[model samples]
Structure formats: C-alpha cells, structure tokens
Target: MTPMQLDLNLLAALDALLEEGSVAGAADRLHVTAPAMSRSLGRIRRSTGDQILVRTGRTMTPTPYAIAVRAQVHALLQQVQGVLAPSHELDLTTLERTFTLRWHDSLVALGGAALLAAVREQAPGVRLRFIAESSTDSPGLRRGEVDLEANANPPAAADVRAEKVAETAQVVVVRPGHRLAGEPAQPMTAEQYAAADHVAVSRRGNLSGTIDDALARLGLARRVVATAPSEATALEFVRDSDLVVTAPQATTRRASADLGLVVLPLPLDLPPASVYLSWHQRYDTDRAHAWLRELARTALDAPNRRA
Candidate 1:
C-alpha cells in the first residue's frame, strides 16, 4: 500500500487482531464496538494485502505473517508512547547553561554583584553575561541571541514577555559640598532643584528627558550642562563637579554611597521607575530558563539597603 493510504489506527487494530485471534476479542481489547473493529480489520487487510486472520470451524487464527510482526508492532507503539511523554524534573546542580542579560549600566552596578552571588550559590555551572541595552528593536531575544533583558524600561514588543522585578524612584544626587546638599530641609523645592546645573544620563546622548518635561510643566527648567552616555558616567561627573544627577534608587544606591554623594528626594512629582525582567516567549516552557527567571525575580524582590 502507498504511504498515504496507510492508517495508524488500522495498524493498532491489526496488532489487537494478531494478539486476540478473534474479531469480537480484539473489539473488547480495543474498547470498540464489534462493527467498528470489523471495519478497521477490513481496512488493515486492504492496506496489508493479507487475509490477516482466518476462521477454522468456529475459532479464528492469525496468519504466519501476523504472528511474525506482532511483537514489532507492540514495540513500535511503546516507543511512540515514550516519545510523547513529558520531560523529567531538571537538576540545577548538574545542568550547565550560559545566560545573557541586557540592561543599563546602573543595574549591573547596584544589583549585578548580588544577583551573581545568588545565582552561583545554586547553579554553580551556570554563567551569566550582561550587555548594554540597544537603542532600536534588535530582536535579540526573539532570535535566541539574548536570554534575558532587565531594565527600568523594556522594549514595547508584544512578543516579548516581561515581569516587574522591582520598583524604584528617581532621586537627586550631587557631590558632598554642592549648594543643594546644604539645604536646611530634607527635600528641596522644585525651584531650588532647577537653579542648579544638571548632568543628564542618556544612552543616545540627548540632553533632555522626562526630567526636562516635568520641569517645563512647573514653569521652571534646569540647565543641563552635559549629557553622559550611562548612569555610571553621569554619577562620575556629579562626583567631581557640581552637576546634579538624577538616578533610579535601586541601581544607584551603591554608587552614590561609594562616591560620597548626597541623595535627596526629587523635588518634582515623578513616576517611579518600574524595573522588569523580560524574555522571549520561546523560552517559556524551558526548565533551565524558568529557573533563571525565578532566580532573577527572587533576587530583585528580596529586601536591600535601598528598599
């Protein structure tokens, strides 16, 4: 018979007939009606071009061919069942994998050390690589080039899946002896903040951002003297000079403390930055991928000095 004409169900019926040696007995074994089993047997006969079973007096007996192939058919069915079964639980200790994460430089500074420590404790064989966030839609995650992307603002692609790992507020930071640092009150006013020269952090090197938009609405604007490519760069400029730098609390706490910079609440009402861990939907069911995703969520959720 041609491959197109061959039927899997007919093969199953053939196996049952060879084992049971009677149409009624095979029907009972397959949990099918006698008529349905007979039809299946007829199809199997036509496909195989064999009598398959013959009746002698009142009992049926399999042909030489059916007896020879019965064991092979049973083994084939068993192999198919094994192929369709679910995967077993993953063992992290023995699973060796490498994960690539893209993010802003500040996150690598603030939480990168802690995140690496946490992951290494359980997944010793796993390695992590961090890259900077790209400007345009690179589709790295979709192409399986990047395993994860963590940032305050993730890409807007609908195909990308994201989970909020932490929430951070923007705070104003400056050198120890900056004019704003000597303010009597803890939180300076918007005018007091606007009066100082600012250093803005923009990967694209743009001198303006949400801070500018917010300041304009208040009928006041800060003088942005310089634009740095990353948060770390902006913080460095803030440390040596009098430029006021605004940064996310979660990722800048360590840097600010190390630089001996003064961190203050933002004078204007700005929305808190929502930090997210994102991945392509392709890795949703991957056990190793799921383990890493959970590891990231746990690390970000756990209380830190800033929180």
Candidate 2:
C-alpha cells in the first residue's frame, strides 16, 4: 500500500496486537470483536508484507519485524493523537481544575496563602492542593500524580524541568532572652555561635547538614539537641527553648516574628538556599498549567521582595 493509502486505525490495531501478543487480547483492549480484529490484522499483514504476529502452539508470538517496529508504532500513535487534539483557549472564569503542589513545609507557610488567594480571585473554579513532601524520593511528578514542586532541591530527572525562582540567605533564630539575642549589635563569632545548642530541621531526621559541614571547615561544631521534621516545627522548638536553628531568612521571617523569636546573622559562610519550581515536560504547553506556574513564581518571590 502507498503512504497516502495508509490507515491510522490499522496502526493503532498493530500497536495493541504487538503489546498484548494475542488477537483476542488486542480485540478486548480496543473494544472490538475478535473477527473484526483478525480482519484488520490480515490487512496489516498484506500492507506490510509481514505476518506481524504468528501463531506458536496455543499462543501468538510477535515476529522479529513486529518486535522491531513495536515502539515506533506506539510512539507514532501518540504523536498523531497530540496533533489531532483540539486546542481550547483558557477561560479562567469558567475553567475548573485542581493542581497538586508538593512543596517544602516552609514554602507552604511562606506563600501558600497568597497563592491560594490569587488563584481564587482569578479563577474561582480552580483549586489548590498543598501536599507535604515525603521523607524519601517519590515518582509523583514523573507519573503525573503531582502537578508541581517547590523546594530547595532540584530534581535530577532528565525529563523534569526546574526553574530557580528565588534564593534566601541563611540566618540563626533564637529565643528573645538567649545570649545570642542579647548582643544584636555585635557580630557573633563562629566560636560563640558554636557554643550554643542547636535544633536541626530535617525531614529524614538527620542531625547533621550543611551547617555542620561549614562548622567542620572552621574547626568548630555545634551540639544538636534535637531534630524537627520541618522548619516550621524547628522554629517552635526555638521559640520556647535555648536551642537555635539556622534557616532560610525570607521563608522563616514571618514565622519567627509570630513566635517572638530573634533573628541573627549566621557566623559561618554558606550559600543561600535556592527555591526551584519543577514540573514534568508534558505540561510545557498546557495553558492552565502555565497560568498556575506564573502565579506560583510570584508568590514564592514575594517574601524576598518584602525583605
């Protein structure tokens, strides 16, 4: 058959037949009758001059030619579907969607309210779901389970796209009456900072982090008395006790102020924590997804702008 006479339906049937490895199975998958699928297979064999699936004893096995072209056929089908899909202009007033965001808890505390308010004002039908980050790596983004992610760590996946939206300097947080809080005008030395007990914020429950590494380089170390699962929880530990926690300045500013804690400059040298917005490449051209990403970027940058 010439290229002009090629049938797209036959390509889909061939893909299913190769994947399922049985005529009956392929018919069931495509919601067609057995004889109808068999007739399509016969036409495919004549068109390609190859018996795509040959009967072996009781089961049907793919021929070498079928195995080689299986992936190509599936990919072509997807491309055709994408090409034929209708494009609809985004109508925020009547559009309804729920976007799932898996962000660091501190980020949620920093910008969740603003993002929600903006989305509600612009698109009353849109909803936001703020999920807590998992202690271990998850495939939620790759599998399309999570719509977006906001955190300091950028994903390493090749297909995932990450954009750095903001960065915040690290600062030390202490209770109002703590020794470090008393000397607001004085620049606390590394030795003085190391002398205080510390609380670490680690989702994985580890006591040591970048701060520990920086301290080690300076031949000093701080004692970590406890570990909190989130920065917000760590700030609570600092609010009522002498334990100090080093956190991103912008993200924790509001929480520290509400808790009546004092913020001090970190004595050790460390890079600022970078906040990245990550998503799968599949949503690159989705209009609604693009709208939400812009709002998210603005919300994340708001704290830094205020500072």
TM-score of each: 0.69, 0.75
After superposing all C-alphas onto the true structure, candidate 2 shows an RMSD in angstroms of: 6.8
lDDT of 2 by residue, 1-307 (tens): 8757989999889888987899998999789999999999999999999999999999999999999998688767757766776899999999889899999999998888999999999999998999999999997786556999999999999878999999999999999888887655787889989999999888999989899899999999889999999988899888888899999999889888888889999988899999999998777888999999999999999989989
Off-target runs (Cα >4 Å) in candidate 2 are 1-81
Clash total of candidate 2 = 0
- Model 1, 1-307: lDDT tens digits are 7857687677667777877789998899789999999999888888778888988999998888888888687656545545665788989889788899886777677667777997798889999999887766577785456898877776688868988888878999999988887755665889999999999888777888898899999999889999888888899999898899898877777778888888988988899888888998666777888988887776665534348
Q: Residue 101 deviation, candidate 2, in Å?
A: 0.8
Clashes of each: 0, 0
How accurate locally is residue 224 in candidate 1, as Cα lDDT from 0 to 100? 91
The CA lDDT of each predicted structure is: 0.81, 0.90
- RMSD each, Å: 17.7, 6.8
CA lDDT, candidate 1, residue 26: 86
Q: Model 2 misses residue 230 by how many Å? A: 0.9
